[model samples]
Each structure stands twice: as structure tokens, then as C-alpha cells.
Target: MSSTTTSITCTGLTFGWPDGTPVLDGLDLSVGPGRTGLIGLNGTGKSTLLKLIAGELTPLGGAVRVTGELGHLPQNLTLDTSLRVDEALGVADARAALHAIEAGDAAEEHFTAIGDDWDVEERARATLDQLGLVGVGLDRTVGEVSGGESVLLRLAALLLARPDVLLLDEPTNDLDREARQRLYAAVSAWPGVLVVVSHDRELLGLVDRIADLRPDGVHWYGGNLDAYEEAVAAEQEAAERMVRVAEADVKRQRRELTESQSKLAKRVRYGNKMSANKREPKIVMNQRKRDAQVSGAKHRLLHEQRLEDAKERLDEAAEAVRDDAEIRVDLPFTAVPPGRRVLTLRDVELRCGARATLDVHGPERIALLGRNGSGKSTLLRTIAGGLPAVAGEVETHVPVRSLPQRLDVLDDDLSLVENVARLAPEATNNRVRAQLARFLFKGARADRTVGTLSGGERFRATLAAVMLAEPAPQLLMLDEPTNNLDMASVRQLVAALGSYEGALIVAGHDVPFLRDIGVTRWLRLDGELNPVDPEEV
Candidate 1:
């Protein structure tokens, strides 16, 4: 916690995948005690950097140094279902020792275990309560908690440790609104060196600074995400201006070169006439021709070099400007009539015992809001016919498609084009490939197997397959659609959703994403489907 000391440092750090794809090359970073938000596009090694700092991954070269104890919360955290709360918090032994002593056991080993941490249980409970896990008891098993609760429980464990350096990657990916708020509060109150990599704007707003990771290295920007964005915007504006100026200079130089060539050609024709008519001495004519040739060559070389320099400057300026592409596709076939009923749930009982009675009409876009394990996904799966309802009847009057959180819609061994073709058998190979290109998979990229694609790419492929099915789904249901997606992918999803003319029922924890997709109604799932205001969500 010293003002002058750095908590984590990396010097000449290097790492790459087994396929020799370099992620970080000779990267040097130094982090002091404060909250720092690490951000970049997907596959930019943001998570990989955190793992190296936490010693979870070994770097190919160089070194990572930490001044004090470090704690890390990974993006995909899986805990044993049988693990008790106290054990997960790392206080089981201390709690056992304290209990044995209180019961009059007085064993030497018990006393040794207690050491000076007799208040560990109290601290653990207090930490859990701070993270909004109020009713969760130490004796409870991991399976008894919801997905959001499990994430908070892991964060609670990290808080109890009180490590000097803390690293969190995509901490709010699966958290509901209330849980995300609790996490934001915890991050604001932390008094150590904390580095978090997340796409959640609200979470990034809590950081004191931003560390933008790029292929070259990390670029530091003071203040939170908004501040960083403003700075980058200004930088991009300047870069654009530079590019324009460089382009104009190149054009002007080319014009000058052309004019010089024309003048030189005229002079050569006049000189040839003078030599043929004997208008000058032979030696003078030969000397004059030699001089003109040398001058012309030098002039052309100078102009060409200037044009090349201008082009290089233009390229560099363009590189400074970010170009994040969005998905653009139209699915007119998915449109439904205004009076048509897309889906009907007739007193339906979900797999998780939740009941619902609703009718979705026309192109209504519904946002399903609920805490983790609240049966939102179950209802979507039931409607998609992936799971049978416990009781009652569910009917869909139009073509339906469901995109699950696990992204299992495509075959791992099949190429992206092949996957789309399988979903829409009537569409020819050329047609499928053309549609896939709009999803940002062009040519060779479209031929990549599903298993070899990155998380964002895989999501795009799955979405493409669902939306481009043979029947063109009129009732589309998505479960946690934004989970594990990068910001670019999320924007692409929003773009795709904006063009859909069919009914939509998307269950997710991302409020910003839901709002961006133009949700017409908000429904909260508990024991039944209840209408709620978007503000409440």
C-alpha cells in the first residue's frame, strides 16, 4: 500500500499459443496501487496478461514480478458442487479449530491451526454480507446457489483474502443488475492494486485509469472508460485529418511529376529538330541532351520518393484510426403480420416449475429479466421444443429458433458455410456463403471449422445459422446472448437484432444490451411471468 511502490511489473514479457500465434511480444507493464481497467478487442490477450501476472500461465520469456500476495478471479470460474461455503472461502480449517477449542477439545494441533486468526469466520461472514450474500450460510453447498450467487461468492472469497494485488476478468458477464451493483461497490472500496478486464461499461466506470492493450504494447489513459473514449476520439480525429493531408500531398506530387514529364518531352522534341537542322554545334547539342537526361532522371526520382513518403504517412495515420465493423443483414422473410400470433403459452409449467400464460403477437420484442437459476432459460428452451414442459400446452404459430448460451447450434467439425447450409438446405452453397459474409465471415474465414473459431466468431456463426434457417424463424428466442461476447460482437448482435422483423424473446443479464435492441416489454420470471418496467430491470 506504499505510495511509491508498484504492486505488479512485467519486463520484456513474451507469450504465444502452441500454434505460434503471438499474443504478447516483449511487453513491458508496471501497475501501482489503484484500480486499473484493462481493455481491448477480443483475442488481444487481456485475459492472458492477467493469468501471467497471477502465475496461472507461464510466459514464453521475460519475467512477472509482484510485490505482495496476489488473487485472481478468472472469466470462466467453475467450483465443485460439493464444496462447502466455508471451504470455498478457505476458512474451513480455522473454523474447525475454533469450534473444537470452544467444545473443550484443547488439542495441540487445534491450537496451532487457530494461530492468530480466531476471527476468520466473522470476517468471512461480513465479507459475504458486503457482497449481498446475506442469507448464504457457511454450511451450504455450492449447488444450492444460483449462477449469479456463485460468482458473488467467489468475489467474496477474494475479498476475504485481502491480497495486495487483485485481478478480475469479465467479472460481471453473468451477474444480474443487483449483483453487478454490489460488485461495483466492492471494486470502488478496494484499497489495493486492482486490474479488471471487462466489457461492462458500468463496471469500467469504477476504475481510476484505463490500460488499452494492443499488438504493439499497452497504452495508458488517465481516468475511467468514458474519459479514455473521449481521449481516443480526439486522437482518431487528428489521425483522420493527417491522413487527408497526406493524401492531398501525394496527389499534388503526382501532378507535379506529370507536368515535369510533359515539359521534358517537349524540350526533347525541340532539341531533336535543332540537331537535325544543324541549328547548333554537334558538341553543344550532345552536351545539352546529356544535361537534360540527367536532370529528368533526378527530377522523376525526387517526385517518386516524395509520393512514396506521403503514402507511408497515410498508412500510419490510417492505422491510428480504429475501424470496428458491425454486422448488416436483412431478413424480410422473418417478418410476420401485425395481427398474427407468434407464440402462446397456455398455463404452461416450465421445467423448473415456473408457470406462465402469455401470448406473443406480431413483431413484439420482449426482454426476459430474472436472477440466475430463475427458470428464464428453461422457459425459452421449452418454447423452442428443446425441453418438455412439466404440464399444460405451449404452442408456436410460426417458425421458432432458440440460441442457447452454450452456442451448440453448429457442428464443431463443420465449416461455417456448411453449418448455415445445413440449417437452410434449400439455399445453395453460393447463397449461404454470401449471407455468411454479411456476418463478417468472408471467403476463407467462412471455411473455418466451428471448433477453430474464436468465441466471438462462433457466436456470429451460430446467430447466422439461426436467422438464416430454411423457414426463417418468426419467433426467435435467445438465452444470455451477450455472455462471453466482446463489445464489437455485442454491437454486431444489436445491429442484427435491429433488422429482425419477427417476434423476439431474449433472456439476458445485460441491461444495456436489452435496451439497445429496442425491447418493447420487460418480463421478470420468478414463480410466474410478471410484467415489470424497463427501469426496474
Candidate 2:
């Protein structure tokens, strides 16, 4: 990949949904040869922008131009399950041609197909291995790999293509810890123009720059996530200070307006009294009255304008400060005694060939960690009763609820209020609305159908339904809860989890998040459950 020449540029870009919901408008961006992290809240058009650049979707206006060949890995990847690994990687024809030539078929077409890439097979295998696809062979079907591995396989395909420009959307969302490390390495080594939209902090830290998408426009920051955060924090502080100054000016202007009005009224009263007492000539008194009225009116207008100007300044300053609200809730009923048994898994053998016996007591917070295809999600599903275990007993002493990675708990056609109501039938409408409000879905927001909600909104609604279910789940399980969530949404999840006083079994690759939620026990699955030190993970 060339380092100096490749680039992606968008000019006067504008886009809107079919329903007339506008997204980007007159947006212009220039990405040079380097790793750039694209980040924003869910629905801020990070993915949409990537799609436009990748030519997956046409913009409503303007144009996108790339200086070199491009490869894209979208957030939602759909590949044919019957496709062979080599076919999915787009090397099946070349591989076949090379084999035919090696078998002594000296055909012109085979030679053309093989071209100068005689080492295509070795490169493919090496790319696979580099991405931690050790056992995944070219002959294996796509259906034979796990979901996380499938993501890596697609990334491997992109890498083998060797395009000068690459775009990845939430690439690590499906990857496990080890696979994410491999991806981080690939991203670090990318020498051409690269733009990735991701919520993974570790992945963002590998970038040379950050493109933060906001409603106003894209704001560029020089460095990684931490650097962007520090820059933003300083900006917020300055904005806040400006807001305070503007507020004080507004107050002062209001006070001055009031004082002027008071003084004007007093003058009016004195003039009337003088006129009534005949203290001066009639004509002179009339002239004095007229002049006083005109001066007072001018003074009042000036003060009112000052107040208005101050208010406008205050509004402007306030706009500069972000309001990323977090979730806050109290779930006292979900609390468990210190000695109570929450869950017991006896000799549990998952369908993915992992076996473990686990006992969760009290409010133990457990982190389930593993590589891709290591059966973490499988074990979670088995314990959640969504999948039957191959062997052994799974029991929960208290009510259990699982928040799956896909967030399939809610009906898309139904509104959030309706979904939560279905799960908590005994709760009154007002009660459900109150709780939903805490989840940041207030009033009409809660009435919107789940299908219309954004990823973050859907996550919050699903979590609300599960945690606020009728029986009050004292044992909660979440699988990859932060997979596609934005940073704000991740913080909201942490805040919501903070209020849950129940035993938790969270299976995820986000170690920072797991630690933030206070995971008391670290368990790694590798054909068996093994205790891992928190520091090691």
C-alpha cells in the first residue's frame, strides 16, 4: 500500500432519508494517507458517511472521490454461507487457475487468470493466520466459522485485496479480544488512507487522527481517542466558562433594564406632579414632558436590546457545551443477600464443546472472556435457557434475564412502552413510563416503535425491558452488550448497571467496560472454565 498518494475526499455532500429526515448537509471532508478514526453518537451518520465513500449508497448531492483502489468492511456484513473460504476471499478463480497450471494444463486462459500472482495461496493463508484464522482453510464453508471469525475472514479478504484506501465500520464489534488485537495490528500497519468508524476505544487509540461527527459538522482532532477526549474536555471547560460569563451579562442587562424603567417611571411621576403644581410655564412644561418621554423611550430600548444581545450570547455559548446524558436508576428490589445463591451451573457442557461448573453467589459480577469461537456466547445462551446445554444442570435461584448481543428481546413493530409493558405486565402504564424516562426514553420517545429507534435507543429500551421485567431479575446476563454502542451509550450502560444490585454474568471483549462495571470474578473459557487474574486480562 502506498503511503503518500492515496486519499478520500467528499465535497458539498448532502443526504437525507426517504422519509425526509436529513442527515449530512453541505458536508466537505478530506482524508489524507493515514489512519483516521471516525466517531460520533449513534445515528450521527458515521456509518452513513463511510457507506457514501464506499459507493454503497449515493449521496443526495455533491460527490465522493478516491485517489486509489478502495476496500470497505461494513458494520453489517452479509456473506453467502455456502461460499468457500477462498471464494469469499475472492481468490477462488486465481487459486483454481494456479492449480490447473501446476497440473500441466498449459491453457492461455489459466495463465491469464493466474497473472503474476503465483504466490496467491501463500498470501491468502498468511493473511488468514495474521488475523488469527489459524484453522480456517480455504476449502471450508463460510457457515463453518463463528460469527466473530466470519468478521475476521472478511477483513482478511479486504487485506488480501491490498487496496490503497480502506474503510471499516465497527470492525471490532464482532471480534473477540485476541482477534481485536490482531485487527489493531493490521490497522497500525495500514500504510494507505484508512478511515474506520468504531466505538472500540483500544482500536481508536491506534489512529493518527480523530474525526468527530456532530450535528454541526465534523470536528478534526490531532491524535487518538484519548487526545481527542482531552481536547474536548478543555473545549467544554472553556465553553462552560463562556456560558457563565454570558449568563452574568444577561443578568446584569436585565437588572440595568429594570433600573432604567424604574428611573423613567419616577421621572414621569415628578414631571406630572410639577405640571399639576404649575411649577413652570405651560408651554415650557409641555416641552419638558415631551423631551423626557423621548429620552426615556430611547433609554428603555437600548437596555432591552442589550438584554436581548446578552441572551443570544448565552444561547450560543450553551450550544457549545455537549449534553450527553447518562442513565440513572434505582433497582432496590433486585438486591440479593450476601450469602444467597444466584446461579449454579453444574457440569455444563455447551454445544460449542466447552464445559464448566460455576456457582454465582450474592451479587457477584463475573466477566466471561474468551477468543472467537470459544463458546462464551454459547454458554451464555445455554444458561439463559435460550439454548439447551449438551449436558449438566443450569439453575437460577432468582429470576434471570439475558440481554443478547443482537437485542432481539423487543418486537420491532411495537413501541418501547408496549415492549416493556409486555415484559412487566403487572406494572402500571405510568410506572413503566417513569422507568422508561430514566432510560432516556421519555413521553413520545417511548411511544416510537422499536424498529424506528436507533442502535443506542434500541439497546436502552431492551435493557429497560429486561431489567424492569415483572419478576425483578436478580440474576442478569448480558452478551456483548457494548458491541455496537457509541461511547455515550457505553457510559449509559455502565451507569444503568451500577444501579443493578444483582448477580451479573457479562460475556464481552471490552475489558475496559467489564472493569468499569466492577467485574468481581474473571473467567476464561477454553474448552474449560478457568479463573483468570483481572490484571492479566
Candidate 3:
């Protein structure tokens, strides 16, 4: 620790929940100032390590040292209902006092001593402006905003706190294109130590380092996701060699064991034959007895023990160092009708008040691209039956199922199993359980309330429910399906979509993701919700 820099150096840290297996075992980490992206498969100890560094949880064996103030944004954030946006930044108290003075309740001396509401409002506005939220009213309640907006609100508050270390877990999961860019800008400009637990490839590319958490321990590399992936591949190849060597050794030991057993059997046969002849006081017979008991017996026992030990060692060497047994899915199916019109929008208008965004498409894939408020979602909702077509006909033969950006179609209060039950009432409970397992939701996870699920989990559960129906939707409408998913999941989902035979209408700004998922067309919208020319924003 020094005045110029803050660092966390932990050695032999071992921690886990009560009654649960160890998540981090004798782990070591030395993190200093700079952005470090944390990536791992689900159930890894990323969140736990965040809690430990923040001092919310203690290490079971070793100590954790944090040099300065740290601010963390967990996936789920709950704020006090009564607190306003400005109150989060310490300007509300001053504004409240000034408001009282204007109402003639403030003491004359105190009123003159304290600043007025107008002054407080100016300061709050400046702070909000820095966060690109100046246009929004400071009085707006957190509960009134969408999850994406609330996330920014919390980030603003945290940024204003001026902590030395900032940890954000899945921070961009709920953010749209614009907000995600804003987050990237914030981290890129930050001068403090930052650890982000995220699966966003775009975000990962901007980080100074990438650290992967495995079951055994953590490994840090001085590059982004791509470089880490390459290094990991090399390491795995090397690790696999250990298994081959151990296997070879085990085989040799087993052969030796068999030979020793045969030799002992021959000795027993010879001894039994000599005893049957009733040889008495024969020196040769006595010598043969000593050979069988002292030499052959001891050698047989030792060789047998060696073989067992060799087998165990082989098993240990073959233990998992890579999780490559994951499912491989490539959905090669389409729903393009034989006719000229796969889908249509004749005066297809979607409106929120006086604004609208419209689309007219043939039997082709189209990307609806725009800022979050540009009414991209509204257009998709109208097509998927979530919202009525305000003043147009959306003709389509194939069934359309939408993966809304917010995934609001599913009730947040219900568990995944319950939601799936509602979606497919004809299916039995056992059938539903088995179906859920396909989407990686097993047992208790399927029973956990949807409200408690993260954005990624909700998306996975929703996809499982939608695709389980008998008649596949000829048209798939996805609004930012990859927003909350990790990079690997995104790739998997994209690969599936690429092979999809059905018509696709996706609203997302992930350029590479769109390309990977087979975007055959692209459409951009404006803030007025009206159709803008493809070239013009």
C-alpha cells in the first residue's frame, strides 16, 4: 500500500458458504489500479470474491486487504423508495432546507445562512449533466424508471461517491446500446482500480486485463478475452499430456501386477504338490517355503498396492481442466412462406403518444437498429402481439414469438417452472421439469422466483418456454436477446439463429452479434418512432 496507488493482496484465501463446498480454496489475488475484467462460467466464485474484497464477507482462512473505499453494483439493486435522485448525491438535504425557507418556515438567520433551492438545483443539474442524465427530472423516482434506466441512476450515484475501487457485476446486462457505450466511456476514463464481472465481449476488449476464475483457482492474463482464450487453449493442450502419461504408467503397473500374481500362484502350486507328497525334513522343501512366504508374498503385496496407487493417480490426472462437454446446438430451420410476402407492414405504425416507428418488410431478415428510446421495442412488440398494431396490418402466416428486450412477457413473481407451466398447460409436471433441465435450469433453479432471476437467467428461461411449443414460430422476433448473456452464450445463441430457417427480425446494436446471427437486412429508426431512410439516422 502506498499514497499513489491502492492494491489488494490476498494469500491463501479459502471461503465458502456454510454446508456448501469450498468455492475459493487457498486462492491468491493481487489487484492494483486499472480495469480488470472477470469472466467465468456461471456458479464460479466471481460474486463471492467481489463480496470478499468489499469486506461484506470474510475469508475463512486467509485475510483480505482493501486499501481504500470500494463501491460495488450487484446485479440486483434495491433503493429506498423515499430517496430522490438528487438525495443520492447529497444535494437533497440542502434543497429541502431551501424549500422550507421559501415556504416561510426557515429561521431568518438559518435561511440567510443556507443556500436556496435554486442553488441546490443548479448543482444537482450539473452533476446529472455529467452523467448524461441532465434532461431527466431529479424528482423522478427510481421505481418509476425501467431496469436499464435505474441501473444508470445507480451508476451515477456510485460515481459521485468517488470511491477508490469500483466493482460492477453484470453492469451492462440491462443496458441498451447507448447506455452500454456510456458505461464503457465511464470505465475507460476512470483513474481508480476497477473490477468488472461481466461477459460482454465488447466491454472485455476495452479492459487492461482479463482474469478467469476456474474451479481450482484464478488465472490472469495481460490481454482481452480473445488472447485469454488462445492462452487457455494452449494450457489445456499441455494439461491433457499429464493424463496420457498417467494412463501409460497405470497400464504398465497393471501388467506388472498380473505377472506378480501369476508367479505367486505358481509358488502356491509347487508348495501344495510338495506337501501332498509328505516330504519330511527336506532342506530344499524348507527353502522353497521361505521363497514363497518371504520373497513372493511381499513382492506380490507391494506390486498390487502400486497398481492401485497408479490407478488413483491416473484418475486424478484426468480430472476436469476444461468444460468442453457443453451442449452444441445449431438450429437449421426456417419459416419463409412460399409466397412473395413472408411478413408485411402496410402502414404498420407503433405509437407512444404522438411518436411512431414503422416497418415494411418482405421475406427477408431485418435488423431494427436505434437508440433505446427510438421506439425499436415498440415496433417489435406490435409485431409479436404484445402491443396492438396502432393503425396498420401486420400480415404473417407463421406464428411469431417475441423475446422482448425486458422479457416482460413472463411474470417476474412466478418461478421458472410455474411460468413454463402456464406457457404449456398440456405438458405434465415431470415433462416440464425435464424440459427445464435442457435450458440449464435444474431442480431448485427452476423453482426460484423469476423475480429473483438475473437478466441472463430470465432470457434463458424465456427462450426455453417459447421454443418448447409444438408448432415452431415461423417468425422469430428478438429484441436484444444477447444483451444480458455472456459472450459464450451469445455465440451459442447466435449460431443457433444463424442456422434458423425462419424469418428473423432483431433489434440490436451489437454489430458483430448481428452479423454472426445472420442479419440479412438492417433498418434504423428515429426518436419520433417514424420510419427513417436506411442511410439516415
CA lDDT, every model vs. true structure:
0.88, 0.90, 0.72
Question: Least lDDT summed over 10 consecutive residues: which range in candidate 1?
Answer: 449-458
Sort by lDDT, best first.
Answer: 2, 1, 3
Q: Is candidate 2 or 3 superior in lDDT?
A: 2
By lDDT, the better pick of 1 and 2 is 2
Q: Give the TM-scores of the predictions, in the order they appear.
A: 0.93, 0.95, 0.75
Off by over 4 Å in 3: 1-32, 45-68, 76-90, 95-150, 174-178, 216-218, 222-227, 258-290, 293-304, 328-342, 353-365, 408-419, 428-434, 441-455, 495-501, 527-537
Model 1 TM-score (2 dp): 0.93
> Sort by TM-score, best first: what order?
2, 1, 3
Mark the regions of model 2 whose C-alpha exceeds 4 Å error after superposition: 1-6, 426-429
Please say which candidate is ahead in TM-score: 2 or 3. 2
Report the C-alpha lDDT of model 2 over 287-360, residue by residue, as the tens digit: 99999999999999999999999999999999999998888778898999989998888999899989999999
Lowest lDDT block of 10, candidate 2: 1-10
Query: Over the stretch 1-537, how does candidate 1's per-residue lDDT look in tens digits?
Result: 586799899999999866455678999999998999998776678878899999998999999999999999988788898999999888899999999999999999998988999898999999999888998999999988877788899998899888989999889867878788899999999999999988889889999999998888999999999999999999989989988988898899889889988888998999999999999999999999999999988988988888888888889888988877888778889999989999989999987888999999999999998877788888998999989999998999999999987788999988888899889999999999889988888888788777756556677889999988989999999988887677777887998899889999999888889999999999999899999977766
Q: Distance (Å) between predicted and true CA of 141, model 1?
A: 1.1
Error of 1 at 267 (Å): 1.2
